[model samples]
Target chain A: MRLLYQILWKDHSRVHLLGAFLGTLAGFVLLLAGIQFYMDLKAVLSENRDLLDPEYIVINKKVNIGNTLGLTGGGFSEEEIAEIKAQPFADQVAAFNSNKFPVQAYTEGEQVPNFITDLFFEAIPDEFIDVKSEDWKWDPEKGTIPVIIPQDYLNLYNFGFAPSQGLPQIPKGVLSMINFKLRLQGQGRGNYDDYNGRIVGFSNRVSSILVPLDFLEWANEKYGYFEKNDPSQIILVSKDPTDPSIIRFLEERNYDTIREKLKSSRMNIILKFVLSFLVLVAAIIIGLAFLVFLLSLQLMISRSSEKIRRLNKLGFHYREISRPYILLLFLLMAGITGLSLLLTSILAGQLHQTAEAWSLDISSSLHGVIYGTALGLILLITASNVAAILISTKKLCK
Target chain B: MLEQDTSGSEVWEAESLLLEQGKPYVVEAPSGRGKTSLLSVIYGIRTDYQGLVYLDDRDLSSFSSKEWSKIRKNKLSFIFQGLELFDELTAMENIQLKNRITAYHSDERIMEMARLLGIDPFLQRKAGILSFGQQQRVAIIRALCQPFNFLLADECFSHMDRENSLTAYKLIREECEAREAGLILTSLNETGLPNIDHSLKL
Candidate 1:
């Protein structure tokens, strides 16, 4: 490093200082950007890291129960369920069902959705509400648990039952939206004539619709028309996706794979793209900076040609004369790289700390520092060439 | 035929001539006569020309560029016609730079030469800040530290007064003899260089 400094700066002290400062600054900018981009990706990744884990099997099949169609479809068989339970990777299978929590409440003066006639909300089952439980201890007296949902669901769904047009309005907690299609022949919004509505639970964008056993049973009988009860979706949780043995074990079985909720290898590709883009941007910034730095170096070299020639006259070799310059540029890069790392590290670190202090609920990430340093080094190496050695043939002749 | 040992030639030809070891060889030549080129050739900087140039009984062409540098850097020194001092460094720093390139430690040789060449007073000042004469004096000090066997002086004494030039010449000759090294000095006018035993006229 010292040798590099000598070569690059031996003849011109100011240039050495200036070039190094600029290089380090460039490095810093590159590093900061790289780290930032990495953190952002990491947040995205860490959130889904569990999803990418080898153990989780996301049962994703789209069941669109829109304005008219009622989803009365049944789920997996008893034998199939038993087979999944037998798999070693299957820790605990929680049966979670997903249907869009219908915002079919009476918007004043508008016809409500027909699917709301027998509002068959795919409520979270007793199994799903007690999903975290090891044994799913049931309270016989309480008769299954109601689900917990975010508060935002109430704003989107309002069951308007004004008494002016209604017979007798049942208050909240008395009725639940069960599976019954509305035969709304009139255009103006009207209160429910058949179904009883109750907010058993609500849902955020994430899945959180739960109906206790009694409610589910009542709704199933009223809406599904199924004599025997059957689930809609069975959630499969795997043990290890990273483990090839487990993956093979699962694949060998007849367990149909659901790649929808499961994060795929495409996540890895996205991460690579983000990192590569940051590096490319950094390289461009640094390349331009180095070009400017190299210009100064050329002038210095042009001037030193005579001194070099004279030194040669005294028995100095071309290599010896060029050594100091080479050494200088090396040190220059090291110094700049060091400085850049320091500067960017502090800024990025502080930002990271601030993020932590503020308790931002961002997820963990997809990429790291390896990508950042790789980029900086490539740029510095290319730039040093411009600064290294360029002796005019005319100077040689002199 | 044995060449005539001129005192110190201010001019020289660009010919492959045998130079005696441990002798004060003066280069007398016009500006474009390639005195610096010959000097550079010996220094291993001029690589394109084809000829036999020997150093310490080894053919210059036989050694690799790296090997040549090792040999020359340790055993050589130059006095640029323009003095070629680093403008950023102080006068003393400029003189010591040659020594630095040669891996010599301390400013002892540089300071000693500075004292002898009458540039010691301006040693602390930068080369660009120094007068032309003062810069020349610093250049002489640098060459003195080079103690080079084959000093290729390219009119380093051009700006110096006759008295200083003579002193510079005397100092150079004394240093060359002490080191038992060769010298190939160039000048347009032969007013200063002294104690030369051989001359090459271009």
Candidate 2:
């Protein structure tokens, strides 16, 4: 006990105390950012709603970072889809067709020029119907279906229900959608009529409208490059890591697969490229935060570790050394995290109030702090540091 | 084992022979003839060198790590080489901390240790606020609280005057006698640890 204190105090008091505190600040924020980044992206791209979340299927190759969708082609061939469904890890497979809705409208007579591409929608597997968010329930009686949009769009227009006159009114029958929107347009504006089926539900909020793939396929035939075309779609793999997606199993471990299959070769590169790119960007951001965290951990270990060792040498148990430092770190990190959240809240509030569009609900949320935004400053200042301190403290003890 | 090398294989290796249970051994050596190393081994920190260290007639090597740690806590004590003392704690708190770790019944051992070393005067001051000499004494008092078969002092009295040295030496000897504990102290000069029960010089 005495020995641990001696060492901790020596380093803490003389040189590294301030550094430790600041490091905690850094660590907390970075870790928070990693989670937030994942979440923010997840909040955007995540599929599924009230049932199985729709999985995304990409090529079985290493996707490059910063690049998405190299080539467009035929959807997964029947054989490939069959193989995917056959795997133990497979949930279910369903073919889908998607097209951009660049222009959208509430009234049939006019269109909102800048409303831009609503995310491509698909006919999801029955399993994925409820797992994503708030599933859209089809109303066969009224022949009316729910429309889902990215929550970003809702936030943009004030929860999609703001009474202001300048923005077009959102149609009432739309279901919920996710909060983010991805723009994949190369040219020509698409309108809401692009979908074939009526929207009956939402995975989240209305960022984009989702309906069965039949609707989008019809629209693509009506508009996309090929004539009489039933557009091919990217295979969506919905397997959780703990429960590997069928595609993940087949993709990993140099397995026996359809060698050089046409669909696999082209779409393989494209899908793998897109998903991997997204995952990679997410990973790099997190990895950078982790690296900084690790370095800070090394510093922390160098500082307090010797002291802990000395304490252990003096017949002190692990708990004796660990308890005090843990308590100290908890207190310090709590303060930092609290202060950061507070600061972020204030900033988000002012941003919402002062900046017009960026203040959308997802950006400015409860107390004007969105999930990621609320924790951003703290994550920036503290999360990584907390991890760094913990890891370093643990390492030092060993 | 301070006569030449620390272990038996060295050219002039001198090993410590145990005195009767309540005696003091003064050891003298150069800055690094394993004085602290020998003390650590006795308390079981460096145990892999060629050694036959036995505690209560049992080889230390045979004990499990947990068992060794338990014996070290209950049966022995150490004054660290760097005079490692908690900077955040008061001098009195430093002594109290030692008692807290060994988990003996709460008593006035802290005050008792303080009074014995005359550290009671600086009891309320943080260790960081104390002078080196005072810290040294507090470190000594901290080591004095453990109920043990041996107290290992690592160059504890190198900076003290003869009178202060004599005071520390007398207190250590008296405490050893009272508890039937042995004293094994290291020094560049045999200023504090004295008398002739067992002597090893390198």
Candidate 3:
């Protein structure tokens, strides 16, 4: 067997085999690294989402000139709301209900400055509200309306408004303690009623000033005079915010939302595209490398054609003659698999370190799918090459 | 039985000719008379003939490649006219390449046969650099390194001098007698060697 190897292996071109080895290794590293990073990024994207509650997306039509001039309504019609309700991503949908009458608020408290301001109110289903409080209900007998204001409005007043105005910063507890009166007015003169209003909670989900649904319904019935208009805002609950179709649908319909909320979904689409392209290029390289490997072995066998026939004449089977070639192929394939995996893991470790600087959690090791892919591809290449070696060597034998 | 005309031949034209074991037969024919072809057909290398050939009552063409491989390893041996030696291998390695398959001969026995054929000093050299006579002696030793019921020597001694040819023939005869195996030696002309009892002419 050693003599057979010595005689047969002498015909192989060293440069050809080395080129094949390096080419295959490069392809394997590319493929494995693509898979590794894709998995890690997907994990990181979902991990960030898990820190927040289920996604609530608020969508509104893009305000164009036509909407500003009243040529087209700046609101969602019944058909549009129904269509949004029918979407697969919208697990729950609600349209904002606004007060159909004018309202003005005045603070009459010693601890707070005297001020009067016009206010608008919107209402949605209580289930969609992020703040859960006992005071969020409507009681006509109590004559107190519970209002939920956006967290951003308060932050703006404290961080942007009050500091520049030389006004003292008010804490949330102090602000909620102030008493205010809301005067609801009817269409006719001297037809108005004043009721007490209290701030119940701050909402991170909805950007509008919200009141209870029942309270708004009662007030609109009492003081309603303006014509009805379609709701301008639609809030929907989604279980999986990383569905890229949400962004595509919004863009196609000319709808607008907070872009930061769907960052993961947008990142997902881009990641998939980049990874697929990487895999395609790697496949081409691996394919060409595989062809080179097959041809190189076949050429070596043909160069040793006379020697093989001589060995066969001496009672060495063609299978025996193929042993050296198969052994060489096995060694090269194993090396590619091992070295590619090692290189991909090293790249992953470097990526993990870089992501750590950004406080992004990325895995430092190769994913399990990377090994499955490498092993599966290596076996496929080795099996086909071994078959080719057997076939060509048999052709040379008696 | 071959594709050529066989009207004047003895073995090809005969109705029935049985060559027995433990006997030596010399097939004498001029060039282009199928001397090598006859040996090749019997060795199962050439299949262009029309008639049936049998080995121990089993049809020769009925054997698969695996069966032929086994027969070549353990049952039949041929010293091809082309000498079929690996030129890159040392003469001893070439011999051991065949001997390792069956382990039929010890290293000392191979060396003894090499010395008898006057090729002992050239055993360690690559067969490609040796003289044709030396390479022929190497092929002879390689052929004898296996166990076979019949030894087919296809003009193997054509390159050797008369003295070396006699010495090699003596060594072959001794090996054949020890195993009680038959010998079919093809030659272009008559060899006046003494012990061959049968000679067939083409």
Error of 1 at B103 (Å): 7.8
Which residue pairs show backbone clashes in model 3? none
CAPRI band for model 1: incorrect
Q: Which candidate comes out best when scored by TM-score? A: 3
What lDDT does candidate 2 reach at residue A164? 62
For lDDT, candidate 1 versus 3, the one ahead is: 3
* Candidate 2: Cα lDDT at B35: 76
Give the per-residue lDDT of model 3 (tens digit) for B1-202: 2223356688878776677888999999999988888888888888788777788888888988788888899888999999999888899999998998889999999999998888999999999999998999999999999888889999989999899888889988888888899999999898877699999887
Clash totals for all candidate models: 52, 68, 0
- Tell me how each candidate scores on DockQ against the true complex: 0.22, 0.20, 0.73
lDDT measured at residue A202 in model 2 versus the true structure, 0 to 100: 36
Against the true structure, what is model 3's DockQ?
0.73
Q: Local distance difference test, per candidate?
A: 0.55, 0.54, 0.91
Instruction: Give the proportion of true interface contacts each model preserves, from 0 to 1.
Output: 0.38, 0.28, 0.69
List model 1 lDDT by residue over B65-142, tens digit each. 557555655666667665666666678766655666665535676667677777778888878898888888877776
Which RMSD values do the candidates have, in order?
A: 11.8, 16.3, 2.5
Higher-scoring candidate on DockQ, 1 or 3 = 3
Off by over 4 Å in 1: A1-234, A238-398, B1-17, B24-40, B47-50, B80-82, B86-91, B100-138, B153-169, B183-202
